[model samples]
Target: MADKRPQRGATLNRESNRFNLPERTADGDWLDDQAGIDGAPPRLRTSVTVERARTIISRNTSPDIGFDRSINPYRGCEHGCIYCFARPTHAFHDLSPGLDFESKLFAKPDAPALLRAELAKRGYSAQPIAFGTNTDPYQPIEAEWRITRGCIEVLSDTDHPLTITTKSDRVLHDIDLLAAMAAKGLAAVALSITSLDPRIAMTLEPRAPTPERRLAAVRKLVAAGIPTHVSIAPVIPAITDHEIEHLVERAAEAGARSVSFIPVRLPWEVAPLFRAWLDAHFPDRAGKVMAIIGAIRDGRDNDPGFFTRMRGSGPWADLLRTRFQIACRKHGLNRERIVLRSDLFRPPEGPQGELFG
Candidate 1:
């Protein structure tokens, strides 16, 4: 093994160095009198890339996905979850969805303005603007960027219906805005918690807020009269699956009004990235885990169909569904389905002549 440490500011092509990128040097690599390499230090380097969003609303024709339109305030998430399905999206920009997806993030600094303009359109039809469906709108970078906050503020100002899904406790920073919108019945939130195990969370979501802190966010949001839900998404088969019941139960106790789960989805590039993570973290169970995941995914690492992709299929899938339902029923979660009201939408007052007398 040569001293194949990653160089600072150097980006290895994902196509070229798929999984064989080295990190350490072997004794043979060093000359008889030369010293070994220490390698580059692990540090986060973030670049402020701005995107001028062409349109504010993204509509999904797929029936399985709930909402009709969604707005992603940012492209690429900084949470750094190894199993993120949104990673491949970076490829569209000629960027590797691997490290670049997490490190080289892009923000729609004009999203708030664009959203207001879109809402003010004369023919615009109102529906809940789903935020954070693709990438977390409230990732750690949000503290500084504030694009998500600004979008929420615009939605609040216009009395537009909105819903958010996020894994960051930093959402607490926007409680004032969210609570104000909730007062008008125009807002709802879903906290995506994958596991409660600190160790697993540390390795799985290295940069995301801790599970306990996220639960605290749930409690705080519910207390503020915001309809809050817990989304235990992408339940990794042999890893975080066992913590499902416990997570839901605790979330219920923490004041989450609804609960939902999505089985792990490994699509395209995500499959190999996930396998590498599994091999590195849980070497012994990596093979067993992949086997079980395949069983749930209908004898494949992934099923790209519209309906069965999110929930998966087969015995393993059925077992997860049964377990989730049983746990939800036992905890009385998602019982009422506190749906957000769309009738309260009001067209923007300042633009599109809506306020003309």
Candidate 2:
């Protein structure tokens, strides 16, 4: 891998639609071609473009997922997680699913207005609106865009139920709004912590905040009377599976109400990208890791079969579930699932107020 793209998670940024992208590359033509006369390539920088969206809330009916609707204020996560399932989405725009998915971002500034309009529709019943299901709502760009903040404000004003999942401590920026809604039984938050080791974390999720900081955020959210959960997501078999018990212990110590784990799932272009990453970072154990994953996935690179997809099938899968259960029981986690209330939701009054009602 000639062009490792320092501080970025991808080893190769191949074209997703080409249909013949290689699994790995020794020479990164894209990076090398950009070299100056002195032969040093320029540092890659993130660029955000504004997207005018007619609608903000997206609906999904997948039985395997927990939420029915979700809102993503931004697209193309800056966290640059090498194993992100959402990476394939970049291909729709004719962009590379690798570096482009993380560096080239889109921000939806009209989300607040769109959300308010949608919530004001006549006879609209409320269910918890999910955030970060596809992309991180509180990624670094949120610090400047504040689009996620705006959407939350609208939800808070209407007393709507909502849930957020993120890896950044940046969610703390809106604790005031979340805590107020939570007091009314309307909000909950989940933070993803894949690995405790900073070195491993950096390579997996290059731009996310450190694991310790995320734990600190859980403590703060819990202290504020907000329902907080810790997620050990995409537990890389050989790489991060070792930290399950340790992460559970830390989450419990941080006052998290519950903890959950999801084994790695590579779908669409993510599989090849992830494979390239393994070759670059864990050459010695890459084959072993993939072999075990195939075992859990039923002899394939991935399994997209309803419930089986979320919780893989096979002895390895059974082992993971048992270990996770033991760890949670020992740490007093996952006693009950967190549920936000919809009874309190009120239709947005709109700028003109409730003229007809």
Candidate number with greatest lDDT: 2
lDDT of 2 by residue, 1-357 (tens): 334677788877677765554432322434466444255344567899999999998999999899999999999999999999999888877677888889889999999999999999998889999999999999999999999999999999999999999999999999999999999999999999999999999999999999999999999999999999999998889899888899999999999999988889999889988998998899999999999999999999899999998889999999988899999999889998899999998788765676765
lDDT, candidate 1, 151-202, per-residue tens: 8888887788889999998888999999998887889999999999998887
In the predicted model 2, the residue pairs found to clash are none
Q: State the lDDT at 233 in candidate 1.
A: 93
Candidates' TM-scores?
A: 0.89, 0.94
RMSD of 2: 2.6
Error of 2 at 25 (Å): 9.6
Give Cα distance to truth, residue 289, candidate 1, Å. 0.8
- Local error of candidate 2 at 291, Å? 0.5
Name the candidate that leads on TM-score.
2
Q: Which ten residues in a row have the lowest lDDT in candidate 2?
A: 22-31
Instruction: Report, for all candidates in order, the number of backbone clashes.
Output: 0, 0
